[model samples]
Target: MNRRLFPLFAAALALTVAASPASAAAPADAYADEVVAYRAEKWQSAHFDDAEKAQKHAATLKKLGCEVKTGAHGGHTDVSHRCPEWREISLKTHEKAHQWEDWLKANGFETRHAH
Candidate 1:
């Protein structure tokens, strides 16, 4: 390579690397962000009286583009879902979870805090 062209070659290489697909991909915290959103939504702390109800709730969350996991916790069913793409949705879900938890408690269903 000509010494006179070295700077130009370096600049081109830098631009190519900066614009590469790998560089443009989501940050390493992409999944972590989802988790954070899920927690902020309070979906992970929701409690149900039975597995069936928990599964149903999980299904509803799934329809909203969240991945849910339901299981028994402290003798009650717990439901948790992954983050949605929008923060607004997460906030909405959080409010919904609060209402659901309150209703469950009122209905004589035991509830537990998230782990």
Candidate 2:
């Protein structure tokens, strides 16, 4: 820790960082802002902060006959799931849509018939 050598050490550290910017960020927030949208559609999704929880949710969605797509977004997973849309059911009847909404809500999903 000599005073005269401090400047040289600081200059070397700066050069090392400037030489490898990507490596410098690799250990930090590399994927913190990354979000890969599986599809361009405006689909409602389930969010899971843990990988295990995401996988379990995916499993249950699959069991519920939902076609799901899960993408890892930084520290969390976003699941795009759809069993049926409100438009797919008979809007004239509205019975199936209500029933579907109830089923989704019962399964812990926030549902709305705003299709």
Which residues of candidate 2, in runs, are more than 4 Å off?
A: 1-42, 85-103, 106-115
Expressed as tens digits, the lDDT of each residue in 41-87 for candidate 1 is 33444677666656655554454345577779688887766442332
Best by lDDT: 2
The residue-by-residue lDDT of candidate 2 on 7-113, one tens digit each, is: 33233323321111221232322312221111112445767677776676666455444578999978899877765422111122244345444444544444435
TM-score of every prediction relative to native: 0.36, 0.40
Clashes of each: 0, 0
**Location of the lowest summed lDDT over 10 successive residues in candidate 2:** 31-40
Deviation in Å, model 1, residue 82 alpha carbon: 2.9
lDDT of each: 0.39, 0.43
Instruction: Find the candidate with the highest TM-score and give its number.
Output: 2
Cα deviation at 75, candidate 1, in Å, is 2.4
RMSD of 1: 22.1
